[model samples]
Target chain A: MSQLFQHLEPSDSHFEPDKDEVLNAIRWNADGLIPAIAQQYDSGEVLMMAWMNREALEKTLQSHRVCYWSRSRSTLWRKGESSGQVQKLKAMNLDCDGDTLLLQVDQEGPACHTGRRSCFYVRLEQNKAWVDQAPLIDPKTLYTNKP
Target chain B: MSQLFQHLEPSDSHFEPDKDEVLNAIRWNADGLIPAIAQQYDSGEVLMMAWMNREALEKTLQSHRVCYWSRSRSTLWRKGESSGQVQKLKAMNLDCDGDTLLLQVDQEGPACHTGRRSCFYVRLEQNKAWVDQAPLIDPKTLYTNKP
Candidate 1:
């Protein structure tokens, strides 16, 4: 992973950081995980937020695809591996605090398991109530006929 | 704080939640803080990310302004109170996992203390190096008088 991975090849803004060095800079939580926000590159829309461990981040950098640590399954979850809603990584950014991540990706299909374009379909209304904004796509249809 | 503050008052989308109920839903980290992502509502541009505790979240909801728990200062920090880079809260959302927050805000001026529109102005180049993509603003000018 020491080899340079050209994220923006053929461009003037080119620089390199060792893979291990980049990973070490992150201040992981007590759970050894960091929160990663996935945003649509072109639209600037926030698609979803997930958790990533060192292995997940390494895999994402290596594969050029979005990978997250599934706390439920305790496994490396590759985006769109099953649901066909893949996140093609465009670029990744670390916050100034180095405890969080921002992922700009070309997202395909819905980003939410509930079949919404974004996980933030619901918002707090004026009355302090939650209001559903985006339409939902049934997860059943999304997972139908697929193993 | 017990009374429902109309966030979207004089509108149709109005509802209310008890303060205790709202706080109880969040699963704060061991540090008694949760990660909060601030996104520009109209633009979908993520301006910055910060940490918020129960008090901060409550204050944001009650005041209709963004407040964060400053880890470095160990105090409740109100956005733009000093730098004039304020974040007006539009709405807030809790992820499905109840561990993180997505705050939709109307940001005024640069959100990054570094004077960038966002803290994520640096990108990982294909050469595996970090390249600055956004123009910098001097914090010295941003916080000139009255500390």
Candidate 2:
């Protein structure tokens, strides 16, 4: 137990080292959070990036589903609760300094609020023009209650 | 053209006034980027979050596919070009602040590196145990030949 404390810096009071020390071993920004990138486990398509405070990080590790700190609401949110496009966690990884996280998951439906499969549908054209593509699934079908 | 300069601030050099004005009109953080979430257009699964510099933001908007700044590499990256789980743009929206963006996309396949459909597959059970729900797809089926 004492050995675990050795690798941890004093500023890391929020993190409790465990077997998967690498996950808990990274340095977080002053906000006590790190940027986590969620991607498709098989296809390797990047879905989104969110901040994870220590609590959220632990919750993610404990729950296996990804939880993130919503900067807008300043609260912890479980991905896909309202949309039903839940991300089933497959693995979690940390970058070299432990500032970033990669989450691999199993997705059920569109992840973006716009009702598309992913949130990255937009792109820049050769002439620097903005264009929108066809939607795969209508958001109205998923969230009938909300607009 | 001078009228456009009226809204320009000293810090706006890195961003185009037209784009910045629009992005700022929508809502952005001090960093001049919005929190855009990426989801699987097909599965409706949430994938990851990435910061969009003005250039990347404009690129995504113009192209109708997702483009983001890779903080890790500090470079521009387009989805699906490497892994093949490309995200085709469907739609885009700005949050109340004009800083946050919501993108709707058509995801081709797995959006995660671990071969899962999404990035939030792991969840902690009530008993404080790590649980993995989904299985991974074979990489061979996803990539015919490495690109």
Q: Candidate 1 docking category?
A: acceptable
Clashes of each: 10, 76
| Model number 1 iRMSD | 6.9
Candidate 1 per-residue C-alpha lDDT over B1-147 given as tens digits, one digit per residue, 9 for 90 to 100: 111222211112223344355566667888899888999999888878899998898889889999999998999999988887889998888654456788999998888775667776446433464645443565567886333
lDDT of 2 at A100: 56
lDDT of 2 by residue, B1-147 (tens): 133322332211133234344443544456665566665555655555557877787787778778877766778878766777777777564432233455667776676554555544333232332323342575446655334
lDDT of 1 by residue, A1-147 (tens): 111222222123334445456566678878899889999999988878899998898788878899999988999899888888789998888765567789999998888776667766435433454534443565667765343
- Looking at model 2 chain B, which ten-residue stretch has the lowest summed lDDT? B5-14
For candidate 1, the C-alpha RMSD (Å) to the true structure equals 6.5
Q: What is the interface RMSD of each candidate, in Å?
A: 6.9, 11.9
